[model samples]
Target chain A: MTGDEACAEGALAAGCKFFGGYPITPATEIAEHIAKRLPQVGGVFIQMEDEIAAMASVLGASWAGVKSMTATSGPGFSLMLENIGLGICTETPCVVVNVQRAGPSTGLPTLGAQSDMMQARWGSHGHYEIIALSPSSPQEIFYQTITAFNLSEMYRLPVLIMTDEIIGHMSERVVIPEASEIQLFNRIKPEEKSMPYWPYIPGADGVSPMAVAGEGYRFHITGLTHDEKGYPVMSAEAHVHMVERITEKIKRNISHIIDTEGYYLEDAEIVVVSYGVSSRTSLSAVYEARSMGIKAGLLRLKTVWPFPEAILRTLASRVKGFVTVEINLGQIHLEVQRCVGGNVPTFFVGHAGGTIIPPEHVLSVLKDAF
Target chain B: MSIQSDQSDQQTHPLDDLLRKDRIPHIWCPGCGIGTAFSACLYAIKSSKLDLDHVSMVSGIGCSGRGAGYINLDSFHTTHGRAIPFATGLKLANPDLTVVVFSGDGDLFAIGGNHFIHAARRNMDLTVICVNNLNYGMTGGQVAATTPHLAKTTTTPAGNPETPFNLPLLAYASGATYVARWTILHTRDLTESIGEAIQKKGFSFIEVLAPCPVNYGRRNKLKPLDVLRIYQEKSIIKHFASPSELHLDLEKGITLGKFVDQDKPTWLDMYYKTTRKKS
Candidate 1:
């Protein structure tokens, strides 16, 4: 299966009942696959007018007590930013798959890039936290897509599955697990006897047990800075309390959300940190450098946002220096430097972005960083 | 407008039960006509044969956007100009849901105009209640897509230069199965129109000419009641009027009545039929 095909399958396995998307390159296959399959499973698939409406529809269905998702590339993802903020503010649980293609503005549609890494973190206009995953292969995208939905539901955050054209188009064997093996979860629901349930009021776990429409739990949801009762409350105090709850939920649960894979980090003199397709190249470079008797290791990030600060901080103290490889000019490199906190040098190895950084280039950066 | 009063006083209306009494004394200016439009919607819902639990209200940002927040239903207050698509999702997901998109002129026709035409074009099953106050009311009487030509507005202090949309004509042209126009003064007619639109199968549009006293009225030199009086004297009930005849003429008269009433296959029905036949 291709990465995009695996992503749709993953969503179906995760019990996503609604797929609302606009067709864009590298990401269109995800929508197409789901559109054909959703009807068979008693789910809905709608090709919305535009990406903005697609994003809005996803949030609407999620609030209507169903797991929903949407897929887009750069321009489409850009249009989705406003409603992504809406999803965050309203705490709507859904997945947004940005199968990234090259762009400043349709720069290269049929090619791969990691240009949207920073946008995923801060594209929406507000102070907030986001959860994003990077998949290096078709098989991994399948797993990460499911993980994205699970985390979105668990944290009440809109999780992003960030893949690029190379991975999204690459075909490979993806093992499908039995239905019983997959863990499925809906949002925590308020008990029947809990009359007058304040929908926005989170429990001790900092997640509100949601109630869907037409369930007789007549509740209000808004995109404004709202009070616990979901009423629009415009004040600094309300703003502080509301923003804190959203940001802190992910901050406190960092242990569960962050996923990373380290390749031979023990006693390494130089480390190459990367994610998505770049990680595969970085791993190859690390092996090539090892064959040449260099003490180099590779760190692959599965979860990009919430940046694995503690692990990077610890690795920075031990390693001599770091080399970061990505398709963009420098997106995740900045995060790595921030997490490293100037303990050691962090060298960037990247392309302006229509193609991937080669292993040889990553090797040179690894050698030069030391 | 549903107040949290004693049981005896509340017994006068069924709308009280379908209202969030705590959020009463809403932000609309006193004598603003959104209250009347909202009342008409509630009465329509009450009088309609649809199940109350199966109805959901979706609204976008504006004065009228507060409709979802106050209504005692599964309400969603979405972002600006997006109520139609949001409600579209709800209807498609649960075809059993009677999804209503309630919003304002700027929200429905300007930033969200594409959604309106497209939803109508698809013949999506939705009841769209657009409160047209001739300008962006909550934003302090700025010019909008529905602002009448030569109308006074904050953004158009010298008078609006852009041609405003003829809402009924636009809805009719966009293939809305049922299209109607009404004013707050025509409560009986508006209520009956809303009830009928709610029962219509495919895309239904009801445009309410509301009075935004603080924002729109102050600029146009008309008080809230002046607009109501204008509706009584200057409006002509022209049911089955041609789409071209529904244009607003502040002095001459605005056509008031259902302009289009017809049936067509909805987006979902075609989708299922085509996909099912292929499969």
Candidate 2:
């Protein structure tokens, strides 16, 4: 199956009952596949007027007690930023899949690029944390989409599945896990029906139990800086408390939220760090460096946000140097450098991005860093 | 009778059960007419016989957007101008729920105009209550899409150059199943219309012309009473009238009534019919 088709299946398997989307290249297939499949499983699929409405619809459906999702490329994702903030403030659980094509503005709609990594982390105009996953292949996208939904429900925020055109369009043999094998984490629900429900009061996990629309919880939700009761409180102090609750939830759960794969890091002198499609390229370069009798290893980032700072810092102390490869000019490389914090030398191998960085180029960077 | 009875000092207000009373002492200005239109909506919900537990309200940002926050049901005050799409999602996801979009003209028409036309064109099963106060009342009376031509506003200091939308005409053009216009002065009629709209299938639009006494009325030199007087004297009940004739002209006549009422298959109806094989 193609990565886009696998993404739709992943959403379906994760119990996403609603899909709101618009047609955007490299991501349209995800919408199309879900549109055909959702109704058969008693779900609803709506093609909204635009990406903004598509994102708004996803939040609305999620509040109606259904797992919901939307898919877009770079341009459409830009249009979705405002409501993504709404989802964050209101703690709405949904998944947004950005099948990244190259763009400052529609640069290469049909081609692949990992240019949207920084945008995913900080695109929404406010202080908030985000959960984003980068998958290198069709099979990984399938699993990561389900993981995205699980994290969204567990954390009560929109999770992003950031894939590129290459991975989104690539066809591969994806394993279809049985329903019993998939571990689904639903949003915690408030237990006390008779008592007054304060929607924003955090549990031990820092996530409040969600109450859906028409559930007799009679809860109020807004995009405003609100109190625990969900009433809009226009004060700087209230704003602090609200932002802290949402941001702290992800920060406190960093152990469970982050994942990384290290290949041959034991006693390696040079470490190559990359994610998504670039990780595949960097891995091949690491193998080539090994064949040439160089002590080089690759660290593949599976979850990009929350940055895996600790792992990178630990690796930085042990390795002689670090080489970061990505399709973007230097998005994740900056994070790696920040984590390394001048403990060791850090080198970058990337461009403004339309095509992939070749393994040979990564090898050169690895050789130079070594 | 219900309106007069509502004024009596009853032990508990009829809408107390449906109100978030803790959030009372609302932010509406002293002479603002949103309170009347909002009460009528609550009364309609009470009378509509739709299960209150299965009813949800959504609003965009504005003074009227606060309606959703005050309601005690499952309510959402979403981002500016996106309430229709949000309510569209809510209704489609849970087809059994009676979803209502309660917001201001600036929210529903200016910023959210595309969503309004598209939802209406699709005939989505939603009751949209637009509190049209002629300007952006919340932001100190800036010009709005529904602000009358030649009307003074903060943004239109001299006067508005743009001709205001004839709301019923727009609703009719966009294929709303039920479209009506009423002022807060016509409380009984407004309540009745909202109740009827709630029970009606497919897209229903109610444009409530309320006075923004602080921002709009102060600029236009129309006091609260003066705006109410115009609503009383200039209003003409014209049911089934051509929406094109239903423009607002305070000195001449304000055409008000149910302008369009038809039974059309809702979006969900078509979705199921097109996708499901008939037994």
- The i-RMS of candidate 2 is 0.7
- Candidate topping lDDT: 2
Candidate 1 local lDDT, residue A296: 95
The 10 consecutive residues of candidate 2 chain A with the worst lDDT sum are A190-199
Query: lDDT tens digits, residues A1-370, model 2?
Result: 9999999999999999999999999899999999999999999999999999999999999999899999999999999999999999999999999999998998899998999999999999999999999999888998999999999999999999999998899899999988999999999999966458889999999999988888788889999999999999999999999999999999999999999899999979999999999999999999999999899998999999978999998888888999889998898999998999988998999987778889999998777764
Shift of residue A357 alpha carbon in model 2, Å: 1.0
DockQ of each: 0.72, 0.81
- Recovered fraction of real interface contacts per model: 0.63, 0.78
lDDT at A362, model 1? 86
Model 1 C-alpha lDDT per residue in residues B167-204, reported as the tens digit of each score: 98899899999999999999899999999999999999
